[model samples]
Target: MTITAVWPISSEQDPNAGDSMTITDPGEIETLVSRLSESTAGAATVWHEGRELADTDTQMHDHDVMALVAEGYGYLSYIDADHDYAVLDGDPASPAWNGEDVDFPKGSGVSPETLAEALREFLDSGERPESVEWQPAEW
Candidate 1:
């Protein structure tokens, strides 16, 4: 199946932040999913459509994820990737604009980039690209 992930552009600050993706066959997806679960250090409730999938063994399908929000966090990037797995931080002047590597609390705030990655990993089963692409939100 051709799985797809979409990340919308943000006018906010933070230039270091962006979205990316890649494709993985079923076998690769399974392997990546395992890695993701193993890599899952903190905690989150995986979701399919709108239903929360508490079971780790639940096969991944094309879906949306609000892992951190479900876990009771504030933002996406700061919460997941940037905090720990995140490689860069954006400038403070224009957080979403300057793309600077500003030091920040680990796993606390959510950067758009990190949020996009987390969602990508969840949906693409960890397969990813350099940045996530998004469309206009209806609501």
Candidate 2:
């Protein structure tokens, strides 16, 4: 299955809208991570076989993310076929989501490197990453 990463174009009026790039190789993960790390507006959604790795409820889907909203820190969370998971790391944080700040529980914050690794695993497996410790998302 092909995995694609989609992120909002900073130029767009809606933060929830943007384009997608197919992750054909591992090297491309750096580019995606860089985009997320460099801009507070940065966020991305991972998709496998054209189905977004998001919750079934559309209202909550915007919160699903792998984003670096603060320098050297970020969060990774998504709902795959099996379960919804958030990376277990630092304290609870509010990261920008769809142009608004959304609260992530404690242990959700992760480093950019960790985020990149999760993305790599997702790209490789086309499923929720098994690379980092995950806890059921509190929300």
Candidate 3:
């Protein structure tokens, strides 16, 4: 399935203020992951049908699937489709999201390869990724 990946063009600007690319094939996922893995400021959100994979009750736009890579580590999260669940990395670490460093919930740090596989899974399945262990978002 095809998906849209949105990311900030400048790490100094607002996270939401950025560009998007259309991913028609799974091969693109590795490239996207590589881009993110190379820079600490690299982050992106993959959207299906112009909507996040997770359901939100508020009118405000919230991310469903988000990934950030920094210092040879990556962070991934997505809202569970079956409920309002916050699926996060298995280890605790502060990664730059958008343009600021935010403290993520406790979870194990993931490698670039793992992050890429998770993105590919989400791209193909359009569901919460089964590759990473999920945890509740602390905040």
Candidate 4:
């Protein structure tokens, strides 16, 4: 299965700042999730279908992003991927646009089986993920 991760675009003022990115590889997704968990610092907001997953901020980092991806939920990538993951600092909106913001009401929580099914649907329909409602940001 191919997973796409998109981080918000960065600005030139803070070029070192990170954003988000889509991950197409399952192995990579797992790895990213693990890394985020390990590097988790404080609580982060997790949204799914317009609902908040965590009531309190608890280790908001890369793990959260990976979790979102696993759950098939879409998020606003207004910061760098690293800051979201590793507790690093980033620019609010230096000057860039990764892509249009998206929302996936059907996606919620982590479920490998569910994600696989969605991917299969894409593959079978001969439709690229970009065409779906929760389209990933362009590279």
Q: Rate the local accuracy (lDDT) of all candidates.
A: 0.32, 0.61, 0.64, 0.30
Instruction: Specify the poorest-scoring 10-residue window by lDDT in model 4.
Output: 85-94
The all-Cα superposition gives candidate 3 an RMSD in Å to the true structure of 4.5
State how far residue 3 of model 2 sits from its true place (Å).
1.9
lDDT of 3 by residue, 57-134 (tens): 654334466677766677776664464546455445644343343344435457778887888887787777887777
Root-mean-square deviation per candidate: 14.9, 5.1, 4.5, 16.7
The candidate scoring highest on lDDT is 3
Model with the higher TM-score, candidate 2 or 4 = 2
What TM-score would candidate 2 get against the native?
0.67
State how far residue 52 of model 4 sits from its true place (Å).
37
Q: Please report the TM-score between candidate 3 and the true structure.
A: 0.70
**Model 3: colliding residue pairs:** 90-107, 90-108, 91-107, 91-108, 92-107
Candidate 4's error at 59, in angstroms? 41
lDDT of 2 by residue, 1-139 (tens): 4566666666656665566677778888888777666553455666655444255665333224444445457677675446765545554553433334234565567777777888888777766777777776554
A best-first ranking of the candidates according to their lDDT comes to 3, 2, 1, 4
Give residue 87's error in model 2 in angstroms: 4.0
For model 4, residues 1-139, the per-residue Cα lDDT tens digits are: 3334333224567654443324444345444333323321111222222222233466233323222231222222212332322211112222221222322222222233333343434323323222222323322
Write the residue-wise lDDT of candidate 1 on 23-67 in tens digits: 344344333233223322222333323323334486543333322
